[model samples]
Target: MSAMQLDAPQVYDVIVVGGGNAALCAALSAHKAGATVVILEAASREERGGNSRFAGTAFRAPHQGLAHVKTVLCEQALEDAERCSMSPYTPEDYRNDLQSTSHGRNDPLMSEIMIQDAWETIEWMKDKGVRWETTLRKYYNIETQKGIIIDLMSGAPVKVVGDGEGLIRDLYNAVENASIPVRYDCPAHELLTSGDTVYGVRTRQTDKYVDFYGQVLLACGGFSANPAMRRQYLGEGWDLVPVRGTRHNTGTMLRRAVEAGARPVGHWGAAHASPQDIDAPLTGDITKTPVIPRYSYTYGISVNVEGKRFFDEGEAEFGLTYAKIGKMIGDQPRAIAYQIFDQKTIYLLQTRYSSGRPIVADTIRELATKLDVNPTVLERTVQEFNAACPGADIGHFDPHHLDGLCTSSSLAIPKSNWALRLERGPFVAYGVTCGITFTYGGIASDDKARVLNNEGKAMPGLYCAGEIAGGVFYHNYAGGAGLTKGAVFGRIAGREAALRAKGAGGEAARFRPCKMEAAISSRRTA
Candidate 1:
């Protein structure tokens, strides 16, 4: 197909589409670099803060002191990436786990770039008022010799405070304070090109079409939340089964890029293993709170459609589990799973961990009946878990020994190693279902964050970062890597775009009418 052309006017140094982390980062970075910037966001008022906000809010990096553990995690991620590569995920393998998670479809050069500059980015975040719980050098250990990592928590030396909302708010505040213009409810429809170079974007506001010409950066997020787009990109049977993430991510900008001749880097999908009720719409009055505590402590067997356990119950990484559950959605009885725990579990979780909710039942049978699972199967699952207690050391169950589970820690007890036995009669069961968090596949770009056309040429004046750019990981995501990647790449794209815009003298070049018509005609014929 041929590229779609657009007529644009009113140029700025940089025009960033989308209001999420990547977009915001790009705009702020460009503005800080002394470029006039504008941000076009679809949402009038930020609701859930997009996927970045809803995330676990951790960033993963190699331990500074323990090179051995850091090296191990990196090697493992690379090995996994090599094993999972398809045609699109070329030269599959990564020196970083974060890159492996992107299926090796990410630009290796960019991945290296981000890894080298990660510490600096974290420091930049600190300077911007986001607090971290730890020092710049300290690492949060995961026990299994995974080594140390950085985190954003209060009271740490570099204390980077806030969740996704805090990060976004701070970024938005910085950009606004710098006098960057943000036009809400404005969505870019197409790229305006001049000769072989991209000049700017044609945008659609609520009431009419407006041309917002500049070096355009597409950060409008992924197609995971869009049911129709999911069906088109993933498969006929695939639907965006709702769970977490903002509703504004509909892949509109992705569609625009594809129409402009950009090639998507990856083909695989990624999702969050969410609670069952995640599909239900939030009541208007229901306030958003941290949901980690409930997820961290809840113990239950996850069964597939065949009524069998699929993986170790205590495993922290939920992507593979979610994918397995997602594959069973169209099967008989519409595959569902349940979480079985007791009152003690709920109470301990609520008292010790934050955000744990109650799901009480008078008895195991009542809980089974409430969850619509086979009573015998539920009983057997519990019995099996109990039989494997004190380490739950089933052959396949590889549990990460954290501080809470080790005998050395004050929080640890004799029964700490045991997966909650679920022996008490008065039980609580909550259902859980899987859903998409963000799209892994996106327009292929270079280390500078310039979007590449199908022919492997960078589209001048057009760039992208965050979920909109792909070819980073092969499979499996390390906690906090997504947010880190978004910020890192957004910064790159913004700086490069600003430089390009400044060079272009603020007036976007115009495409020759004859060539533009020919390109459009060829598309119609194709």
Candidate 2:
């Protein structure tokens, strides 16, 4: 094997695969720990960050107070950061939330690791030149009372700086500062192993196989873009769903790992899906990683192919329960659903609505016809919905909170909260279909980030993190949790891999309690 200095390892201590956030964290952490590491990124330099690039808006990490937050943020943002809530989140709080969200099906140990280490790992990344901010940013909307609401979740609410792209760039810069080598367009084709004891990665460069031997850490993503894998694992119509993020996450490493005896866990065909804009492509664009999804569906109503409602639009908060509705829409007649809104609450929308033109008509019948649904069914459905609503007007609606306004008990599916009738003229509807994000199921890894074999024993010299290493999320995920988990476990995996490679540490390196230092760093990168 001709060594690709970042291309092929001549005598490296660690080989990190998939150069997204998780892989970057692993590479940087291993490098910091004195492991001569090389990163193998699938995409070329231009199309670098994987799913990690899609996130940056928010993450639920532990913080002591505004002071703790101001430490990583720029001095300019400190004033505004003090205004927002920077309350502490204990390990128990995070663990409980994880358990409740996954319905107790999440791996207990892995969840614990994610919760405990998230804060520390985030601080570590900051120490390595990554900047984080808590500055309240916003843009005014026509419908809001104040005209401008804080851009919390939509922008960088309380996560790393510059969102996902910013976070990745900083890490990449840190790698450069450390003089770490990264080989772009060189994906791992196979894991070189002897009797299940993995040793290195095999890749093809210029039509020839080259082996890079080292302790392998697979932070590569899951199979959101691979249709065959999606169909085989997730189910039928899953193949048609749009990829919400990167097209490069085709589950190649996952398949190779599974073939190499790694056990697959989580819901095979299950994924975190969304009712994406109809104009959105099957593979998302690199320039526009959506800042806002079509979450305003709850303010109006979602109708199915037969021109009727299937589930309650107001069952829960739109921001909280996207997975449930996405699944419902995915299970619908063509895996399609139209979010019907009227002129009354149209101004309440942001990026998702304003991004494209909507199907508009002066009447419900015309709008239904435009949406290709039975006009009579649509009219009748609206009439019934309006009749069921006690107070159906702009005056009674409240978008900021779940107002008690609702549809009457007579309707099949009641608009339980924020219920307003679509009675006004020029009704607008945006056709949407399910967009699959990432597969929840993956190779089982232990608390220390070691990929477990079929019998549940740790696969020596092998570690996994990010979306590829499943067990943390089962069906649904909190908005920023995936990013946090990737960083937390990625740090742990890299630390352990480096220690094991040098034979310098034992279990202490693999599974030690989180030690968060308040030693703040002053690095500004927006």
Candidate 3:
């Protein structure tokens, strides 16, 4: 919906730019804290949720047990969540996850903030009219292929009460109920700055540019959808990779912030990507984004267009290493891979989220033909994999924990785990390619989500959160953490910006500045 033309005030308390999980979270949080908040979204109302609408309803929030889930989720999901098995995700676990996932390159302060405040953010969302559900996982043991027990995800799996849409819906409801004006189809082209302070924004409206004055909170997301930025930062073949989220995330907000002197942080060349259907739409399909990725590749094996296996599919690090798998596929021949699963592992497929139509055949050779892979090479690959499978040291083929059932290392690319032979008939293959989720590089912000100037000091009246604010993620990422990061930091930025706009920090603390490289160097050393 378009922003209502209430009496034109000189400025709002908080002007949250962008519309998504993070932006909505910020707007609602600011409104709750007794501030006039306005949300500026680039897309039309129909496409306003941004990438979040295309994602699975999963969240990586901290929780104690099933009881905590029951309290947070809606009544409809309570029963399923209560019946589901879950483990408590301690703050330390979240910290370790960030460290291990980013190989310790993530900002320690920001990582700690996410781990420390994730639970609070989820609870805050619940208070803001949001609901949650258990992000239940299902991995079957090779012995129980008929589907007896499927392990929940290896670690804690927290699903939003509803997937992405539900999240945005609830948040939108809150915004609407609060009468927070959200100007759809209006994109903020640049920040309205006064010395070191950001007082408002220069927005491009229907047919003209309008100046929106306010203490700005940026939740505009990263530059993944920007073709030129992708080619420039991520290098060749990057622009060809389909975007798994919104086309509106053209890095406009990010580039604007950088031009305004915000220091960029995190991996410029890296992003959170995944293996999506080869024929899926250029951007994420609103109907099936969360389920589009060929994540179940760990249960099978993937072959490139040449009918030759690529990387070890089993390296699908249940928690952290999932991001690498996408780029791996992007780097392959024609940026395509075929995930093959035989009858033995057919029951293990989570095909409910499958993005594109599936190609099925009774035999491996037939499946190869349909997938356009060399049938002879496919046959040899399966045969060789089968020979080494029976001798694998895969104790019990347990799906709960890490089952070390590995293929022969002598092969060019071995399936590190879940090495089941494609001996059964009725095989299936899903052609897949990489789709970029969010970019890794973004404006540097503090734990409180205050935007940092190039000189390392906080930029007055400017705050950032969501994918637009970077630091924690690098090349790798955990599955549901994106939403959590957005919510947690969004809430923080909203609250902090609201307080600052309310004159809580005073003039002396408001206008601090430092030298450029020195500020970055000091932040680095800290």
TM agreement with the true structure for every prediction: 0.74, 0.86, 0.89
lDDT of 1 by residue, 134-253 (tens): 222122222322322322121111223455566677777777677888887676677767544776676765454566756888888887667877777656445735535677787877
Q: Residue by residue across 1-526, what tens digits does model 2's lDDT show?
A: 4333223234467889988888988988898889989998888888788887776345666666555656767556676654454445566666766776688899888887777777777778878887777634422243343434332332113566676678778889998998999888887888866556777777757665556767889998999989888988878788887888788899988988989988888766578787777666778675554643677787788899889898888865554567656778888898888889888877766544677668989999998888889999999998899888876455766665567788889997888887888888789888877877778988999988999989898888799999999887766766567888888888889988998888834432332121101100111112
Q: Candidate 3 on 1-526: residue-level lDDT in tens?
A: 4332222223577899989999998998888788888999999999988888777756776667566656766677665553456566677777777777888899998877777787778778888888765655322233333334333562445566556777788999999999999999988888766557776777876554565666889999998888899999998999888888988999988988888889998898999988787776777667666667667787777888888887887764555556778898889989999888877666666655344677899988888888878899998888887787755333567554557777776687877767777777788888889989899899899878989998999988899989988888888997778888898888888888888777743442233222322332342321
Query: Can you give the lDDT of residue 188 in candidate 1?
Result: 69
The candidates, ranked best first by TM-score, are 3, 2, 1
The residue pairs that clash in candidate 2, if any, are 4-7, 4-8, 56-163, 56-164, 234-269
Model-by-model lDDT, in order? Answer: 0.57, 0.75, 0.77
Reference-based TM-score, model 1: 0.74
TM-score of 3: 0.89
lDDT winner: 3
RMSD of 2: 8.5
